[model samples]
Target: MTFDRKDKDNVTLLNFYLQLLYPRMVEEKMLILLRQGRIGKWFSGIGQEAIAVGSTMAMKSEEYILPMHRNLGVFTSRNVPLTRLMAQWQGKLSGFTKGRDRSFHFGTQEHKIIGMISHLGPQMALADGIALGDLIASKEKATLVFTGEGATSEGDFHEAINVAAVWNLPVIFLIENNGYGLSTPVNEQYKCKNLVDRAIGYGIEGLQVDGNNILAVYDLIDSVATRMRENPRPVLIECLTFRMRGHEEASGTKYVPHELLEEWAKKDPILNFEQYLLEQDILTPDAVAEIKANLKMEIEQEVEAAFNEPEPLAKEEEELKDMYFPYTSDPVSPEGPVKELRYLDAISDGLRIAMQKHTNLVLMGQDIAEYGGAFKITEGFVQEFGKARVRNTPICESAIVGAGLGLSINGFKAVVEMQFADFVSCGFNQIVNNLAKTHYRWGEKADVVVRMPTGAGTGAGPFHSQSNEAWFTKTPGLKVVYPAFPADAKGLLLAAIEDPNPVMYFEHKYLYRSLTGPVPEGFYTMEIGKANVLRQGQQLCIITYGLGVHWALDYLDENPDISATLVDLRSLQPWDKETVSAAVKNTGRALILHEDTLSCGFGAELAAWISEHCFKYLDAPVMRCASSDTAIPMNKALEDGFLAKSRLKHTLNQLLAY
Candidate 1:
């Protein structure tokens, strides 16, 4: 029979093709629910199913994966119930993670489908981390980080792969090279002849496989997996496949010339595989028909099941609400080994201690290994812990972030560095979509920290300086912290490292060396969300955080007559409204201050909240003193003017005016 003999093994090519085709068709069918009037938009991995399915099949159930958005074929082939997949596509309750998971970003730890991060290339670091974990846990499992050729252009690709290669992490960095990253073709995007060739840059093995050959794909992955079990090194395999449809449902191939589409269409993987099977006499014509029929029915049934299942309970939406809420602390002091040092010293010490205890704790970033980080924050880390733990990364922000994500998912506690806070935009997806949303997706854990040098006091100008806390403050399931003093800095940072979610630890560059404080020797735990009253007053509640908290402290000290209650809301995500309300009620006047621009800043959210709940007790309208709505200035005079320089005397005069 032509259908049955397609493989040397029991599997048939016809059956494999159906495994690819039917599930995709069904997933697209579900998308029609929200897309009014049958708008046919899909990132169809149609031409690349053989590779997706074969690689998926070859992977052990225990092995994990970091899939990108277009790998729907692989997801369906893995037996993910169609209904849940549909729920995801439709943004309904029935979707993965109760619809908290974005469309095409589905994950299940049970299924070893670790995640599908929304951003283009951030998953690389997460996969590296998970691989680290697997090694630490001594689990006989490997991780796969799947991306596109376009994604490799992201800094994350280089960072993640380099670290994985250097650390000998058991991860396979697979690039689903579908020729184009959106409208831009691979040829136009880079000078590299092939993505597979990039592995040499990381000093790892690289290969190119025929993505249309399911058996070849399976064999290649199986070989890689086996090699990983022993070598524990990262490798890259570029599957030279073509995407049948546009990048996403929203995109049409209008941008792609018709000739190119038609030419590529002639080489559809399913058709090619089918012809190969027919030539080999692997599957008979009659048998192929039966398999297709069965696959179609199975896909339809899964869709029906997904549609019939009750949507994730809308009334119980509160269950998914903890994305930003901080956990309460234990009454007893968290007992970890304590150390006495300066605040930055404590941060450095914590890293030293943690890495000393856990060999798997890897610290990577720009100039972190030898040059002691751009901040010199990681000074002597490499000398103390060696290159494995303190790694100097390339100048690729996306690559470094993606590598950190991979390391974390691989079971390494990665402290990723972005040379400056202004550069965080380069690694934004790693912080937001992937690392932040990972825990909710796997329903497991991804404990990692992303540290950046933030704020602007030096003459670094507009480009080199920024405090983008407000940018990340709006993202759920992420904790953003800025410390006013050294003790809080060390304690809170340690807390973030142990936390199961991703954290953005912003350390102000101005205060790093200037605002030194004696941190007690040994380990001490600081509760994350609980706001502390630095100075108690009855006249007005000066609600502030981060660099502003330090300014407020100095202001309050100078103007004791104002009788201001200074509250530092340490953790911005699970922000302390209760603390703010109590302070406002006690003082009857509230002022919100921050270093960010005035327009839609974090303070704006706090002010609106006060207007809703604490407005009745306001003795004065909430006053805000923040940077004017403009980019930070390059000139010293304009720069000073643009910033919200504190004047307690000026603010008090206003309250008196009211």
Candidate 2:
């Protein structure tokens, strides 16, 4: 693995020459496939081989890589079979994602290379989490992540590097500055002389190298790898190269100036490396020709074999329901010693119990370690579980979510906390795009729990106080749960932690202390996507979740005249539609309520469902009562007006009258 001066130049030449051949051959074959209409679209990394090949060669075998679309060289150099790569391009079942994805969006768990999504920036942030996990576990291997110049323009780039720098994570931000962000030129991307200079802002070492020179890249990486083995600091490396072809085959070279293409063609990495081997007397003309011929034949054979491989069989709609979510069944209610605990205490207890039972569970959040989180939910966790398990991260929401995905990929369940549910927007892409879709796309479960401290009863203004569960409820391939009672908080969270898919656990901020109840003592998990009946009546059905359930209960308690059944929808995404429907039909009237703004809240969906399914059974139209469509104000009066329990009472009275 050592590429030192002691090694013969001929040895290095042969190694580099072969590394360059695979991607170039693949690129050529992809172009052929594109013409024949065998593949959907093709992205050629024709000139950018040196960066992936050299850097991968310098790293250890066990190290993980989060590659972008233009990193076929990385896949090739890291021993990914050519047949599998070709099969992936053809969207066959033999592919890593089993025809779930096309193009470069496929990777295998065995290889430790996560499949790249179209959003290039989140993977870079994800690499930070992978590196952090290894670091905490005291692993020596470092993570190398590839990103383009355009991706650096994203906030994820800054958030990722900032976390790496602050935490001294063992991750390398390898920026392939290929002189353009797709059609846009590098001149318009940023004003900085070199992309590496931006690394100084994050207080990390920055280096720019001739990306065409494999030896230079290898040496710099080798040195950095040695230093990082001891120091564990992030490094920003800008590989100055050019995209020899159009962005993709269909994109064409039309937008690219003829002069620029002509200039870059002369500096082609593979051709240049081949010439260097010949000039150094390391490879004869016949040897070079033979190698090229052998590679061409091998690639052609693999591509042909991949084409013959059967495509993935189409799954039935019912069978595909739990492909991403397996645990759709009801929960087994707990029967054990009961402890009267606050909702927050119950949550902490759940975490403590889960971690104590499962060694693989790790808790991460901003100010969660010593500061014990913003709401002190994890006040004593760091001392009990140690800092490595109860990790304190930088204020990067995206990185936290992205890192959780990485951890889940590596066989660890991460319990990541968002300071406030409203702040989840910062990591929205990672949550909705990466984490939510991973299971559905590749049958890869992202076993992560996002503990959201949500709801608007607190006067923490628009940023800190908000109910955003409805946002994730609309998303596919995600488990959304909002526990009302302390027992449900403890039980549902325990279930979420053990679940194979990504679960969004929304803990109402107001309910943390106010909604105290007798929580079970031992570890138990309530069924997800199931509703609980707090009180049963016949005249009307009030269906609600989170704090809304309590508001509905209060209205009935004070009135005593309202004969309404109270149903708490603990799980929103895969809601208890059957249970709620039965209750609505039995009562002959339905009311959906929540704390999120009324316009597009979970109430809308519930109301729609009741109206459609129980139209004939109902005595009156399905009605909804939720906060007004406006930001929660800091003033107590305005905040109360925005989400007052009296509103629920008035709305229920009108529904009864109707």
TM-score of each: 0.84, 0.95
- Clashes (backbone N, CA, C under 3 Å), per candidate, total 61, 1
lDDT of 1 by residue, 1-658 (tens): 0122323553655466677666555645545542754323455666677677878877887788767776766677677777677667645675666666565675675577755555666667768767766765667777887988888877667777876786688888889888788889888878988889988888899999887677678788988998788768888999987776777757856777788778777767666667776666776788778877776777667766666666565554665554533444442244544444555565676666566666777787788877887767788888887776677776667656666665554556677777888998877776677666666654545566778787776767887777688888888777887777777887787777766567888877777767766665555557777788888888888888777887887776776677888999877876788999999999988888888888888899999999899888998898887877888877877777777764444766687568
Model 1: which ten-residue window has the lowest total lDDT? 1-10
Cα lDDT of model 2 by residue, 469-562, tens digit: 8889888888899999999999999999989788999999998878789988987888888899888898899898888888887778888987
Flag clash pairs in model 2: 331-527
lDDT of each: 0.73, 0.85
